[model samples]
Target: MLGAVERPQAWPSFLHQVGVIELGKDRIEGSRLLVVASQANRGATFIAQSVTKQGLMRSYVQNGNPPWLFEFFVNESSNL
Candidate 1:
């Protein structure tokens, strides 16, 4: 959802806003996915809903599968 131009910088800020849970090499991939998801979720209400419904599709395409991206829905609703 974030414009392509915004994605690079926006990803980190989005991760911080969503409270990244873990750190290290294992978590790096997940964090990246979460950042992508967060950016998609922030673009607009519809985009947020879409991203949530799709369950990290953008993240998957962008960064491959990350375990935490799957767990994110358990800890936080996409509505936020």
Candidate 2:
């Protein structure tokens, strides 16, 4: 989760509602940062988890030196 001080000052409320917030200036080898969060429902959880998986897949496709490996599981109803 991004700290309050790190969050954008003029962020959109709708983005927050959908669970996407804090597009940071930081980067990994020039790739911009994208932070997602959800404080409420299962829809938010799905967005967060889906974005995470897509990001990982993108990284693996772009860079495969050591072969990126990771595992995650999310059950939206329980927000696990």
Candidate 3:
């Protein structure tokens, strides 16, 4: 389960519509948001589609090796 602060207002509705029932959560400000993708393009595409579809902020792929092999951060904004 996610902490209440970690659950964004848009998450329940948007994630369910896309079949994302649950995910690990972290603090919204200055914290990393990670998503796993096998290919870089797919990762980019997923981020683009989700941001567009869900009225979320636009984020960029982080440079350098992240904690996870397929990790990227979602820049925090009002949408989150």
Best model number under TM-score: 3
Runs in model 1 deviating more than 4 A are 1-59, 62-64, 78-80
Prediction 2 TM-score vs. true: 0.22
Model 3 is weakest, by summed lDDT over 10 consecutive residues, at 18-27
Residue 70 of model 2 has an lDDT of 21
Worst 10 residues of 2 by lDDT: 65-74
Tens digits of lDDT, candidate 2, 1-80? 34432454544444553244323433335654445545445454644565587654454346642322222223343454
Cα distance off (Å), candidate 1, residue 22: 37
Model 2: lDDT equals 0.43
Clashes (candidate 3): 0
Write out the backbone clash pairs for model 3: none
- Top lDDT model: 1
lDDT of 1 at 48: 53
- State the lDDT of candidate 1 residue by residue for 1-80, as single tens digits: 23322353566656653442323434656444333444445444443575689775486578764676455654455555
